[model samples]
Target: MTEEVNNSAPDNSRRNFIKTTALAAAGFMIVPRHVLGGKGFLAPSDRLQVAGIGVGGKGESDLTGVFSSGKSDIAFLCDVDDRRAANSVKRFPQAKYYKDYREMLDKDAKNIDAVVISTPDHNHAMQAMAAMQLGKHVYVQKPLTHDIYEARALTEAAKKYKVVTQMGNQGASGEGVRKLQDWLDAGLIGKVHTVYCWTNRPVWPQGIQWPATGGNIPPELDWDLWLGSAPYKPYVEKLVPFNWRGWWDYGTGAIGDMGCHLVEPPFRILGLDTPVSVECSVGSVYVDEFKRGYFPESCPPSSHVIMTFEKTNKTKGNLQMHWMDGGIKPERPEELLPNESFGDNGTLFIGTKGKMLCDTYGANPRLLPLTKNASDRTRPKAKRVPGDVEGHYTQWAEAAIAGYGKIELSSPFEIAGPLTETLLIANLAIRGIDVQRPNANGKGVSYPGRDMKLLWDKQNLRVTNFDEVNQFVKREYRQGWSLGV
Candidate 1:
């Protein structure tokens, strides 16, 4: 499958009109606010009207978080599966419901001031691009996009459309990241050199084969629509609602599932960009006494990937980042005592001066050896989010109300895009391991992508040495679906 990147300029008449109208509304509000009510009063119309796509599970929680901020209203709810959307539908009965997000945006564009997307990985780019084309502020869930190309596109689209965009890596807004940043800035952990981020995910099934028999389609589910942008396939049992994470077509494997939450802090603290090179080795499942199971369609049970990044302002030299998943972890630092937990899922930053580690979402950060740490280490230096992690939702809503470029978001597309690309690049190495080709002698197969460091051409978005793996960079969408870049 091949994809052609669209480079034609997008029409901006609607965006310009919206900006003009907003300016006029601001002019009207400037004079009436003092006379209409006392200080700090907000009329109902002032509340941001938010539309939610994929309003189930994480989607439901995302809308709930925005609503709890008291600065937004759930104006519309959309989901492909009615059964999955029941709770959200009951909670926001007043909001319009739709099985198709395209129909929702088409009809209610004017009513919606923003869009919150918590869809499966494959659909994120298309859904977000559609909303942004209509000038809607978007808050996309973590990992941002399913592919490296899509992540880069959305990052650029956020700027092109002048939308207030935030990726749902809520940990970026937590006190722990700020604390970690402060330590780095204050030279507590001098110049971070090597970092390790690990997760025990695939808590769902992985390293398995696709079910041979297609399951009966549920009455409330639209299997075709659910496969948006992905190649059409029969409804596989248990792939919906969750288990899609392990599949190559619908999900981006464990790294895509948890890397955004795990790798985000080090990405931010170090201000890293695209990596220079990446290499990985994955664990194989056994099918018999001698042969190993080969299921290229799914992610491996475990993987240890190393990515090398050029020196950023925070580092003295090139940095190496190791990512391990499926219950894998790096060597425990000697300074850490035996009793203290190294955490099942966390990030460890090794610096010239000292070492610091934090749990998932950058929570519970601490320097090595609890006994030697000084009380002054926790001194406040970095700014804190109003409500820490929960504040991520409100910050985006308030920023949208304040208009583009008004307020800073912790995981805005500017930061999230590259961070996402970093993880996806690691995945490239993982997937490359499975790339099979006929041998030069035409008798057996050769896995050229294995046991070698894949050089990256960041500007071109391809693996320089291993061309076979580039196919995973930008996927070919199904008919009628386009990123429309």
Candidate 2:
């Protein structure tokens, strides 16, 4: 959404505090709003009065982007952590604050035209669905849902509410990513046969030794609220503020954390739908040692998930998509020189005639043809694609303020829902009972693994494996917190 200053500042001191605290917290050089606010289209006169849920961590960044876009008023901020919410209170003193997003939505439903949700994976579907049900546009961070059923429910909710929506896969709007799509469309890399996407997540909270016996919950945080819809458990410090990434109940581990960014490009450009089968080859390490009482006796810390898409009548050919986590690397693409290596995180598309490699976040993609002569310095420079990765936030703000029709949404639910579904399948595969074995074609050759790879009936939004993975596709919600269909 566009970030335009509302000329009507109800509280000058409060506005100043927001600007100053945000600058200090960001630890970046600050520019005055007026000076930084160069002439650009302002948000519509009927700008959205926006509220931010989960206003810590990523939520702060999301807030700054929306405010800067000049299209919305930061009417309220919500977070499970009181300390984090205090920061928002310092900045937007005039805005209301709440510990529970449900309270904020209930109290300010009339005033909040839109909501930006930067909460944990488990909370996304419920929050976004609630906002949509109330007729508020939503901009939710990706992967859009913690599970597959929520993904479908969210897409339907967006349509039913007829609200403008955007998934926070900011990379989807990157100029470089779009260029990668164009290159594929232009046949720069012929008939992509397989794709390998990797990420260096768990960097902040990954691979921790499971928490030892429990301790008292910290007073500053409300451990119960933090638990939210996840099963109730005693508070643990490692699971809070940041460490949630490693846990199964509250987070999606490496796959859900980075897949939206690393895997989206290929999933989009390749027009991948439901996979014919899915399975994971997990690391031997048990997850219990890392965090206390988080993972059940079941679950692993790291895995290599192989998802195969049979040649649908519409697909050009059978395509194999492999996903790796925990600093794993794919077998080197043949096109790269013997010594070449991809970034710690990124996607590699192996085509029939060549290969295309790009950064983990879809920056600096290049086409490597099968034949590269030593004298090929004479080869023309690869075409350049311009982008403003920062512009995506602005794009969402503009769309929210302009009432949907006037502005284009970069990653609407139509695109993001399936993307999230595909990524979440990898999470399910990793937790599945069977470790997928590789077949003659190097595709996943395992049982229960195939159970998670349900045939996706896009038109009907149902899985063919109704008896197996369907239960995992969606989850049961705690009472009073359930998201309705």
Tens-digit lDDT track of model 1 for 45-93: 5788889999999999999999999999898999999998999999998
Evaluated at residue 178, the lDDT of candidate 2 is: 70
Per-prediction tally of clashes: 0, 24
Clashes of 2: 24
TM-score of each: 0.91, 0.79
Local distance difference test values of all predictions, in order: 0.90, 0.72
* Model 2: lDDT of residue 11: 72
lDDT of 2 by residue, 332-431 (tens): 7666777666578899887766677888558877777435333233332333222367677778777766664566666789889888878877666665
Candidate 2 lDDT for residue 29: 35
- Candidate number of the best lDDT: 1
Q: What lDDT score is found at residue 155 in candidate 1?
A: 92
TM-score of 2: 0.79
